[model samples]
Target: MRFYGQQRLFELTTSELERYREKTRELDYCAERPEKRLLAEECREMVTELEQRKNRMLASAIRRRQREEIEHALDEAEIDAEEIIRELEGESA
Candidate 1:
């Protein structure tokens, strides 16, 4: 017989989170510099592009982890289901 258990989520390592924070700090620093500020029209466009790319990369990383967890859970469920079916067949015979 198979029993369903709680699903424990796996989170990113401390180093990964720290690296993300560092990138955020760098972006803020770039924005605050007077000479390098994104005030100019051309610079504004470039800043926007950079921000979008950063956001996309972060989102992709989060989505990748979520996808992996879901895949792991599905695999576990398949194995449990197969075991249950086998046990039931044995009980009937």
Candidate 2:
């Protein structure tokens, strides 16, 4: 379940990435100048940084989902243990 805040963040990140890509393309088109070439390198670095950020966000989401699943499983196991203990007491009584 993606919350509204998360969805908005994802959209913003995508927009920023696209803008960086556009800047890189413009620089590349006129990269005969040394300064333009330098700016293009920086633009490329920003694109790489954005890609890494996306990967990190995906990893975080995966970890969060796995943690929730583990907690749910532990809760079910605890309930089952309690039920078994009650049955054992009834038999001994």
Candidate 3:
């Protein structure tokens, strides 16, 4: 099979991203060691892609469950935005 956009959807949740991010945070990015530095660079790139939704997963040719998850995430973000706005307004007033 062929994908036009060619970006493989890895089907990841936000929690999965968080886990990877946390795991990477614990790693020692030792500048003295080439391998460690390379690892750090690669991990940073991967996490950046994941956060940008450009990773090999969670994408446009999405399955039903993935679509639902995206919708739910947007809904939760909307609620969080509203709460933040309310808090800021309360603080100002």
Runs off by more than 4 Å, candidate 1: 1-41
By summed lDDT, the worst window of 10 consecutive residues in model 3 runs over 1-10
lDDT of 3 at 84: 100
Q: lDDT of all predictions, in order shown?
A: 0.58, 0.90, 0.65
Question: TM per model?
Answer: 0.51, 0.81, 0.37
Per-residue lDDT of model 3, residues 1-93, tens digit only:
135344323334456567666656655545467776677677777788677774334444456467778999999999999999999999999
Give candidate 2 misplaced runs (Cα > 4 Å). Answer: 1-3
Cα deviation of 82 in candidate 1 (Å)? 0.5
C-alpha RMSD for every candidate: 10.3, 2.0, 16.2
Query: Using TM-score as the measure, which candidate wins?
Result: 2
lDDT of 2 at 74: 100
The 10-residue segment of model 2 with minimum total lDDT is 1-10
lDDT tens string, model 2, 45-78? 9999998887777787788889999999999999
Q: Which stretches of candidate 3 lie above 4 Å from their native place?
A: 1-11, 29-31, 54-93
Q: Scored by Cα lDDT, where does model 3 land?
A: 0.65
